[model samples]
Target chain A: MPAAVDVGELVERARRGQPRAIARLLSLVEDGHPQLREIAAALTPHTGHARVIGLTGPPGVGKSTSTSMLVSALRRAGRRVGVLAVDPSSPFSGGALLGDRIRMTEHAVDAGVFIRSMATRGHLGGLSVATPQALRVLDGAGFDDVLIETVGVGQSEIDIVRLADTTVLLLAPGMGDGVQAAKAGVLEVADVFVVNKADRDGADATVRELRQAVAFGHREAGGPPWRQPIVRTVASRGEGAGDVLRALDEHAEWLADSGESRRRRAARAVGEIEAIALHRLRGELAGVGGGRLTELAERVVDRAVDPFTAADELLTNLHTT
Target chain B: MPAAVDVGELVERARRGQPRAIARLLSLVEDGHPQLREIAAALTPHTGHARVIGLTGPPGVGKSTSTSMLVSALRRAGRRVGVLAVDPSSPFSGGALLGDRIRMTEHAVDAGVFIRSMATRGHLGGLSVATPQALRVLDGAGFDDVLIETVGVGQSEIDIVRLADTTVLLLAPGMGDGVQAAKAGVLEVADVFVVNKADRDGADATVRELRQAVAFGHREAGGPPWRQPIVRTVASRGEGAGDVLRALDEHAEWLADSGESRRRRAARAVGEIEAIALHRLRGELAGVGGGRLTELAERVVDRAVDPFTAADELLTNLHTT
Candidate 1:
């Protein structure tokens, strides 16, 4: 079993603006140890305090650089911020190289900013299994704004929307046909789409294609009725970062005024609860004693009875006996 | 509520070469109505009788044409076959076009061949929520062989390996770099790799690259030693379909000899059972007595206690009262 961390103590330290404590807590959660439940329980009150904005797109879309710029922009507005950068797991080894933090070293010593790198840790999604819990920790720790940067590999990119109140999708020009961006699963989930590397020649056409795609109705109920705004950003120079942050602020305001924020929060709560319940049940099922369950499984497989009826019978027997 | 069909009777009719019954059963399963469980429960015993082969790759790689050719080839071998073609769900409409079936209409009336087109039905991975259950129905109906043709949408393609006893990953010549294949999450899961459209330029290089990728891995004990062979095929012309089938047979034989077949089947059963359990639990939790659970969720969200303890306490209260 992984060593247990004192989640309360970690949260208190993070609340007091201790970067090391915050980083360590984020790492523990990202590793997805079973003990994450204890930490999440301790951190729940701290969520809903920070505005979480998620940055996601295809790999090599300059997500990390864009995130750094966004963080810088938030800091310039005198708001203390937190950054969580998520990387993909290597299929061969199930390990992740958290290389995004290298670009954010400028904030390492800044008292106003905190940056942490995270891995998916066997989770199929781009977001870490414990990401929502970790976000709760950061939120409880009194960060005014939190930025999550995700390595968008495929369907997993969809998970980021659940974790963030606002989602920005980054697209680079000259990468592929502009249509590929529309074909990729990210188009439907993004609230604000950015064409990064606008200095490239095809940027205008990519922006046009993205506008058309967004014009095709994709937003869920309670979001802005208009299409998602397509902005051009040269993130390396920190250009257009402020506009992105302002857009996020406007989205947050809209969510608050339109009562969509509560609906999203409720949906997220239900999703999180369901996920936790499933995880716990898996653990319990794995721990059931002996070859008994296996025998039952074999009997079911042999068609003595169906799995549903057999499962109910097993549970009933366990309860009654 | 959708009307529930008599799936067992449907299966019996389908086995006697009734096309409409087979289509109806497939439609019932695809919609994920409550009746799917009943149909699957009745059909479970009849599965494990068919040799299941999965074909997957990126879109525009001729997967549908390849599937058509494979169905033709299997018929020539005098084997009764069933093809389940999976299509992508439209992000905008949450429905599937199911276009692949149009290509395979020539076999519609062939008694020895049964063809069905399935949509992803909002499943993130290439496989449908009811895919395994549907496969069981076809298998139980006494089809000598079953072919699952996946949507070839990158990561979801990996889900096919779990359901299939033998998996073939197809590639087209001059397709993006071999690294893109690895990044697409296909290289690691394929049992046999095929370079379709072999008449196209760069077929040899694609094959060589795939061979190199396969050679880089040294096999471990439990999993099949990844000796994925790269077969060059003009699938539209049926030039190498026979060779593909022979390779599939050899792999099947290897799996049986090494006891991996039993292990794979066991893993699949456990996976299916887990999915079913979670699905049922979600339904139960949703209907668990109104505002009481909502109150508990709010308290849990407020950090009053850990979710595990909260869940336990709730269950304990329910039992005692």
Candidate 2:
């Protein structure tokens, strides 16, 4: 086991914009370390600062490239940015994540940019459970913006990735992304739609289809509906990066002006607290009754006790600290 | 509000293989009824009698068609079959599920078959949580076989679908499925590989690539590792279904002989029990301290309390009955 460290001291260093401190905090969250509760307690007050931008789309849509381009643009705006590339691909293959990291090497040395690739492995509840805590670490560290770039082909995966201040759904030309996006049910959560690789064939067609879809889908209730703008970009050549950035800024403004920012942040906090509690309950239940869960499972298989009763027994007296 | 269901009476009817009773029980599980605990307790004693076979593949791979063919084949052998087509596709779009139901219309009227399409919505843990309970209902209803066919595009989604006694990973000709399946990290969970649409061009190539990939990947550590068999089938034409069934039976024998069946079932039971406990806890927490979770979330947003502390307060005295 790693030696115990002072979480308060780490948080203090992190608040001062120390890279090592932020990295350590993120590792703790990713590793599901025992000190997480303490880290959250220390970091919570300093959070609620970063503008979280989630970039998601189907595979081969250049999500990583778009994220890298955004990071460069955000740095140029003199903003400290953090990037968490949540890989939703096969856990057995690290090739995509490896390729993503290589593509992000240009910003690796820039102090204003912090880039990390997160694999969805061993984290029960998948990306949602781990990403929120990691996002908190960046928020607590005083980053001006945190970009969560994930492979967002799956519907449930897209819902999990919607825990962001501004979610930008990226699509590429001729990928047949409009119908694909509708099929993935991602059009509902996206605040901004980005059509990357705009120089490619059928870029206009993709954008036109997306525009039609946006107009067709019902917007969220109440306060003036901020129309989702579709931005065109060739992220590989760093073209239209400024346009994407402008859209993001405009969305962020709409968010604050319409009071959607407050609602989104609060909803995010609710999800975060609930997820943390669930994670803790799971840990506690696993170790309860001196290894009861496994024994209960055995009994359940033997027909000695029903699973519901077994679950009830496990849940009883699962006291919180 | 729906009338309170009679749990014991329903179980008795379900065990007698009454279609209406079985459908009602499945509806309860899908709806996350408050009487789920009662339903589970009533159903547990009759479970463990069915063979669960899961068919999963990427979109456009014809999982639903394969499932329909397998259902007809199983019915011919005098085994009652139940199919749960769990849709992980866009929640807003029911087109795929509708298409699947239409294809299974022949089996819909068969007294020996039960077919249902499950949307992965309103279920917090997505397909995994809702599916296990649904499987149990079928098992208790005296079905000799339960086949779960789902779109397994994402890696985490595949892990959730592995709650089967034998998992069949489907591939198609000329879809570049070999690399795509590997990329989805699906190669690890497959017990048998089925190359559907075998009459199409590149069928031999797909099969050859899958054989090579299977040979390269490490098997689960155990006695006499089962070499995953590749079965070719034209599901749409109802050809080669018997070959796939034979492969399934062979794998089932291997599983029982290797005692891996016991392990997988026990592991699946553990996950089921835990998911039930978590779902119940979430319900209780949402009402705890008279909506204290929302209040705590508001406080966290206002920087009045750290999330960890709020989570602790919400978890405190959350007594499970």
Q: What are the per-model DockQ values? A: 0.24, 0.43
lDDT of each: 0.66, 0.77
lDDT of 2 by residue, B38-66 (tens): 89888888889999998877655677777
TM-score of chain A of each: 0.82, 0.88
Per-residue lDDT over B1-321 for candidate 1, one digit per residue giving the tens place of the 0 to 100 score: 776677678877866767777767776766666776687777776667889888876544677778888888888888889987653322111222335335667887798888775543354222425677678768877788898876443334456556888888888776452234333455555788888999998888877877776887546377556477778889888889889888888898888888877767766666555555555554555556235556666665555655555566545543443
Deviation in angstroms for A1 in model 2? Answer: 4.6
lDDT of 1 by residue, A182-259 (tens): 244656667788889888898998888777777774666754563578889999998898788778888888878777
Best candidate, lDDT: 2
- Can you give the lDDT of residue B225 in candidate 1? 64
Roughly what TM-score does model 2 have, to 2 decimal places? 0.88
